[model samples]
Target: MSEHDVEELKGVFDVLSSQIPALIRGIIASVFSEEAGREMGKAAGAFYKGLIEAGIPNDVAIRMTENYISVFTNLGEIMKKLSYKMEREGKIKKEAEEEKGEEEAGERAEEQ
Candidate 1:
């Protein structure tokens, strides 16, 4: 390949490499948010139970339950986003592998 072609390929690779960190961060954030939400729900339930045993008002207990439900709902959304991101990443990796295989096949053919 010509020097110009090599430089162009390198530039493209550099751009892809730079974006990798951001992609990974988004995926991690999505997963962690979901996990944290689950933990929060458990803690909130325990708190509500304690409050009830301690003779807290019915209104206060209802409000606490609502808040916990809201947190779980938000967590469900985050998990959905994470699932989509992971699926997209899987497709990208599969395509890359296929392209690499084709390139290797071409090189072998040329050698023969």
Candidate 2:
């Protein structure tokens, strides 16, 4: 991908990062909210109906929808893992710098 593509991809991830918490909250609410689940079911049904009406074969439509959802959700999952890795690396780097600073202070005290 070109540099511009990389940046646009990063923007997608930045949006997901902010929405992750709300997504989690929705998941939790769905457990106790029958209306929410029913609404989502209706939405899915409409999507399939629309696809069939568009002349896509039944089997192909189902498979296409499944693939689309799988890949889209995996994109967010991939970003979550990447963000976790970057955060872990940042913590490790911070700790290493702190230790180095302490060692330098110790050496200076000893030299005096």
TM per prediction: 0.48, 0.57
Estimate, for each residue in 1-112, the C-alpha lDDT of model 1 and write its tens digit: 9999997986776566556545756755654576766876688788789879889897998797788677756766765666567667756876886899999999999999
List the global CA lDDT of all models: 0.73, 0.69
lDDT of 2 by residue, 48-67 (tens): 78899999999988987777
TM-score of model number 2 = 0.57
Off by over 4 Å in 1: 1-54, 57-62
lDDT of 2 at 70: 59
Clashing pairs in 2: none
| Candidate 1 clashing pairs, residues 3+ apart or interchain | none
